[model samples]
Target chain A: MRNRQKTEKDTPLGAEAAQRRHRAVLVILAAALILCLLLSFTLGRYPVPLRELLGILAAKLGLPVEPFWTRQMELAVWNIRLPRVLLSVLVGASLAAAGAGFQGVFQNPMASPDVLGASAGAGFGAALALLLDLSNSLVTLLAFGMSLLTVALVFLIGRYVKGDRLVGLVLSGIIIGSLCQSATSFIKLVADPTNKLPQITYWLMGSLSGASWRDVRLAVLPMLLGLALLLLSRWQINVLTMGDDEARSLGVNAPRVRARIILCSTLLTASAVSVSGMIGWVGLVIPHMMRRIAGSDYRYLMGASVLGGGIFLLAVDNLSRTVSESGIPIGILTAFIGAPFFIWLITGRVDHYDG
Target chain B: MTVEVEHLAFAYDEKPVLTDVSFTAREGQFLSILGPNGAGKSTLFRCILGLQTKYTGSVRIGGTDTKTLSPREMAGLVAYIPQSSRPTFNYSVFDIVLMGASRKLSPFRAPSREDNERCRWALEKVGISHLAQRCFHRLSGGEQQLVMIARALMQDAPVLMMDEPTANLDYGNQLLVMRQAKALTKEGYTVIQTTHAPEQSYLFSDRILALSGGRIIQDGPPAEVLTGETVETLYGISVRVVSLENDKMRVCMPINII
Candidate 1:
């Protein structure tokens, strides 16, 4: 007489509580992202007041608001700080989302956009443009194109190696990443020691100081499309995290789905790097942290990664301006901040390797 | 459910693995495929599951050709339990069982109401519903095998295909799995299992199909085909079949290696 309708297993009480924790973490990160977006407006060198920032935002959203801000204050807030803040959130979220996707596809805990050579290739392209003294738009275009091309090279190499595609991809990515990194270093060596060298060096170190409305427009569509594709692939990714044979038994085409995921992740990483230079560790560290916060299920991890990444970079960008008047490079800040946080994660880790 | 294979032949890069292999099993019948290593037992299972499609001849389930069924459609008719290989992900047992319903699930969505119900039913059928909240990798070998069984049941296919279902387990767990698999037949499931244990064939299966060197070397009821001479020839070793408990049970043990 076993009435099996409502066994304790039916509800999975422990997993549901874990799921609740994951959802709460996501909600908190999203709320923090919004708060960071609003708070970032009140920061900067020229000092636009919080009230003026709000009035300008309301006016921009097409809401009627009293003109508490002067034209100079409005211009500084609207044309200057707004684009930088928007671009930072967009680029941060894109990199973090792409990193999570790439980690799933590669089936490795250490994977990131930089692991695939996207960020390095984009860095070389930006340095080449600066060496040629090209326009900002041309630098962005070259960086984006070269990043895509570098990943394509990795993909081609992976196809030829012929056993265990994920391993092959990681190998090819390391090779191509080193090659692109050396090329960037070579460009830096040959440039003029005074002007172009410093600019190239600073760009390589990563900064969001010169962001504009045009840069945001150029990167937005591709980044959004990449995020949408990764979000849609979450369930399949859960299946894919099991090995290829298991995925096949479940009627999933592992290679084709893996390719689609790779394409989306590459597009996101490339676009983000082209706009913001090599903002390292946001891609590497954010996804790892999110995996800890939101369990291994990609459904919870992907959304949390996107929002958490935005909040992280938004907070860091604010720190860049606030820690000093001249402002530190965001890449250096990320490394200095990311490395210790990674050590903390390792010390507290519970050895949850997939197998 | 009825499974029919007619002149099924397959080769990998011209090295023939299976040729002229055929069998038929009807509803509630248990067919045990007995073979040594490299006897094409797994290749045959792959061909039936539609994982290897370039083979010649036809595999039919319920009189419908396997070729006409897409992988999703094929999954609706046949389910497989692979030999125990440690999975690489730490997915919970519930999520792993729910994955058996993946063919019907849309991409990027949570499990539907029916999916959850099926998962619960499969867990209860395997009598391991209490383990649903635990991580799959944390389970013991026998429990992991049973979890996979629950997953296959969630597929709700009429025909169940298992490759060496009791390959690596203790004696008690082995009998536990064998008993559960045998019990499914009474519920009108056609179970196709490959096992190295001739005793399992003698004790549990309704029919025995012995394969060697890519062909059906012997086929009949276990009492008729599993003799001392035939068992020796099949395994390339001296073996003895002993009856125990007043002629109600039999056991096969190799007396020598080659």
Candidate 2:
């Protein structure tokens, strides 16, 4: 009687303790993300001091007043830094969410968005658009369309072979990626070497140089929609990771659920790739880092990955712009930072990696 | 609630596995299916679970045709534990059990307080509440089997099905699992288990079903089904069934070269 009452009293307290721990982690991550975003906005060639940059941002957002105002500062803050930071956050969030979903669906931690050739297909489409001197918006649309087509082709090839779906999907991705890379090379070969070649080469290396308000608007909505869908379907994703037979026993329509997840992940990856060209490391590394932090529950795992990925990329983008006299490509900077972190994670004493 | 099957026929890529097979399981009863390696027990289970669409059969759960219910609806009525279960990821014991509550959860809704309470209850029911935080893959074979059973209990269904529930268990764990199955029956839940061990059926099951060549050879009480001739016919080996002092039975296979 008394014992039972005591036990019941302890239950909610324990649960509340767990919830508080989770909230503490979230708050820490939120602070880090804001700090990185602010630093990214301030650290550029025409460096605005942090206090003045905040005043400029507050004024631009229709806040109370401005501390100091100048046309050059306005251009630096609004036209340049703000767009780049916003694009980095959006791309980082999308790629991390996509990677998390892919890893869940494939039941393999090593799986990423690029495993299905979506990035390669998008890269090829963007290169071709560049060779033909197409509009930037038109190139983004073409890249998205080609990515969808490539994913569909992979799915169809998997079905046609009547093989294990994961194996078929991976093999098709490898084949399609090779073909797309060769086609991209062909486009580079035929373009005017003096002009289009360098542009194509830099785009392949990836950049936030052309970040604009239009690009931000183009990416945020779809990426948000995809992330929301993934979050909603996290429980189903949890069951699917247990394998097909167990998933079926748990009342999931395994094939349909997997298809919906693949669609969501590919859509997110395609949007991010289209906007940023091809930022490689965020998709592959962020989810791994989040898994190590939050454990393997997709509910918390997905959220942590989004916050962590956004902050990571913002910091890398800041370094890309400020590290040298001539700005570095965002992709190169990301790899330089991300590769060591990935190696450390892999070589660490984490037992989950055995899977 | 009772499950009824009639005139069940199934084939895989034109190779027939089950032909005109039928059985009925009543509420609060323990039924064991015994068969050789290729006797189509798993295929029949799949058909009843509605996982096999290419079967010609009528399976009814609680007087409703199984074909009419969606997978989620069926899962709300019947819970299945496979013969050998492995976790692909390093999920904790509590996390694995909580997934069984998914059928009752909406896509956007998180697992509620009641859900977590039920998960803890199920883990305690299997005598592994202490292992709730441990990684599932770190457990031994028998412990893993119990955790899987705990996961099935989290479904809160009226019927439970298991394939070879005690296959890899040691002597004590095998008896422990059989006792759990018996306890489930007493709690007003129907249980259907497939096993190769006839002695376990005699010790715990209320009814026994023997299959050969994808067909039912015998279905009756344990005493009537565990005869030497029936065991010989099903397994293609001579066996002896002897009663022990404590209302338990023992099955021994005779030495034969052929």
For model 2, how does the per-residue alpha-carbon lDDT over A248-303 read when each residue is reduced to its tens digit? 77788789889999999999999998988888888889989887776677867788
* DockQ values per model: 0.42, 0.47
Worst 10 residues of 1 chain A by lDDT: A1-10
- Writing each residue's lDDT as its tens digit, candidate 1 over A176-282 gives 99999999899999999999999899888888888899989999999999999898888888777776766766767778888888899999999998998889889
* lDDT by residue for model 2 (B110-186), tens: 67778888988898898887666666777787888888889889988888998899999899999988888789899
In candidate 2 chain B, where is summed lDDT lowest over 10 consecutive residues? B249-258
Runs in model 1 with CA error above 4 Å?
A1-21, A44-49, A351-355, B85-87, B246-248, B256-258
lDDT of 2 at A27: 76
Q: lDDT score, residue B253, model 2?
A: 56
Which residue pairs overlap in candidate 1's backbone? none
Q: Please give the CA lDDT of all the candidate structures.
A: 0.84, 0.83
